[model samples]
Target: MTYRILLVDDEAMTKRSLYKILTGANASYRIVGEASDGAEALQIARREQPHLIITDISMPVMDGIELIQRLREDGLDMDIIILSGYGEFEYAQEALRHGVVDYILKPMKQEQVTLLVEKRFDHFMKSRQTAIIKSQLIAPISSAAERIGHELWIANEPGMRKEMRSLSGLLDDTEFMQEERISLLRDAASLISNRLQPQFPHQAWELPYEGQSYGQASESFAAWLDKLLNEIRDKRNWGKRGVIQQAIDYIKTNFADSELNLEKVLAPLGISSTHFYHMLMEETGMSYIAYLTQIRMDHAKELLEHSDLKTYEVGQRCGYPDYPHFTKRFKRQVGLSPSEYRKNMQQA
Candidate 1:
């Protein structure tokens, strides 16, 4: 597949230079759109959804950092690279935390840019895939674990074993390294432990997963699964609270994702929406929507009070893609606009 790219810069010359390099002989990249500034670039990005975005750190209206923030809030996952002059180099470095894949200096070294994108071609492709999956790579494993946990709840050893054996198959993404596979296996173990440990909290059961080879990791997981099956032969009480805590933990971790929703939360949970919602409300004294909103707003408060980022940037980072909506929510929740909150924090 030919990689699609969006080029953002005020300089016509820079755009020309990059276009030729990216589209040269034997090049597998296609420049889909060119924008003179970040604002226009953002509009084009919404329309084109390019796999890669090459932006200049200094631009009219929005600039590179805010552009990255906007893309992040919008959940448009794309590889980012910034171009900056020598004087603005340090300022450009600030965009690194915003997930720019890499950056280049103003006087374009065609060879270096080519090499940069080429070396990261695999990662770019992976990002493309992740964008499509929306991180179901982890979701599938989570859902499977939840399903198997159900089997384990009923002490259906046969059913649990079948589901346990199928865990490794979910890591079917292309170019999954051995270490990555092991990590996923470990995550599976954690999910299983969450289900099983509640029944016997005094003595925990864990997957005997060490830094072993792929084959050994799979074997270790299966062995642990067998042990789990043998130990929990009869149906035991797995508290609903553990499931609720897992859901809360997931919300806390993914609160920044604008696309965060009940469906995504329910995948790993294997619990009904009404049940999960009521459980969350009972445990936290807040509904699911309230809890999630509280987490995002609290994070926004921290970012605004501590960091030098703009109000809109803070809002977007807190899972509010629309600035006005964030303002409304912040006012309704915190009784102040983000800027006002920061001012009060400064004076305190």
Candidate 2:
């Protein structure tokens, strides 16, 4: 299949050289667009939606690391090759962390670039096939499990062997339900839980059902099973949440860093500050700044209630350099001054 590629570099000659080399190599490849810096590159990326992006690490408006971060944050799955002239280990490490498909040190040789591109393209295809298999398998397994669970509920015949066989098939399916799948699994669990249990623990009836022999499943049992499955599904589905969770995790881990802010968070992720703000608001129901403020305020409140740290110290610990500003925000969120909040918690 033909692939569209984007070439982004600050230098005009670099862009021209790569474009010429790639377009000359094969009829299957096309140079879709070029950009001067990270910001323009992002604009082109959004517009072109290329299969592959080649970018330089150093640029005036935005850098390659930031570009990769932005694309990933936007949930774009394009393969990327990061180029740099400086051979900076830190830049390569940062690029890898944001999931760049490849990194190339500049003084670019045509053969080296071609080899890197070929490898990444093959890897991308394999990954895509795996994802497809996983998507197709989830529903059938879930349906089979539900059907078997229901059959066991109704039949007095020793069905553990049959049920186990069905479960084995179900487990083999790679397809998993996402959020709505959890609801269906919960319903199936409920169906299993409401059935009655056999009294004697025969080898066949020794199937584990709430620490008893199972004759039938009950509603409570189903709810319990549903809860367990839901937890598993939620954990698995976290990657789908994308940048919102990434931003939240970063904030949680680095909130105490004095320089932590919207710019710092979005820059590393390679997202434009504007788009980052919008996505954060959509996912979290709060603007980036407001979220950070809330995090700081929450931390301050905890320190006020649990620790001997003074309010200013608490503010500094939560990324607020200004003590009065921290106090003002804390009071706004908690409806009490730091000292008063602490006093009330102690009294209570």
TM-score of each: 0.50, 0.46
Q: How much does candidate 1 score in TM-score?
A: 0.50
Tens-place lDDT digits, model 2, residues 1-348: 667899999899998989888878767788899999999989889989999999999898788888888888888879888887665778888888887877878788999888887786676666666566544444434433444443333221233334444544443333433323333344434434433122111111112344331212223334443443344335335347577667777886788887886777876687788887776654444677777776676567557766998878988999878888877878887677877777765543
Highest-scoring model, TM-score: 1
- List where candidate 2 sits over 4 angstroms from the true fold: 24-27, 155-160, 163-348
Q: Model 1: runs farther than 4 Å from truth?
A: 25-27, 125-175, 183-220, 234-348
Query: How big is the positional error of residue 72 in model 2, measured in Å on the Cα after superposition?
Result: 3.6
Candidate-wise lDDT, in order? 0.77, 0.65
Give one digit per residue, the lDDT tens place, for model 1 in 1-348.
788899999889999999988888336788899999888999999999998899998888888888999999999988899998899967777898887888999799988888887866777777566544434455456646765765554455665776666565566543567777777777877787786565444233344545678778777767766666656543233343578768877887899999999999999889899998777654554677887887787678768866999999998899999999999999998777888878765543
What TM value does model 2 have?
Answer: 0.46
Global lDDT of model 2: 0.65
Q: Highest lDDT: give the candidate number.
A: 1
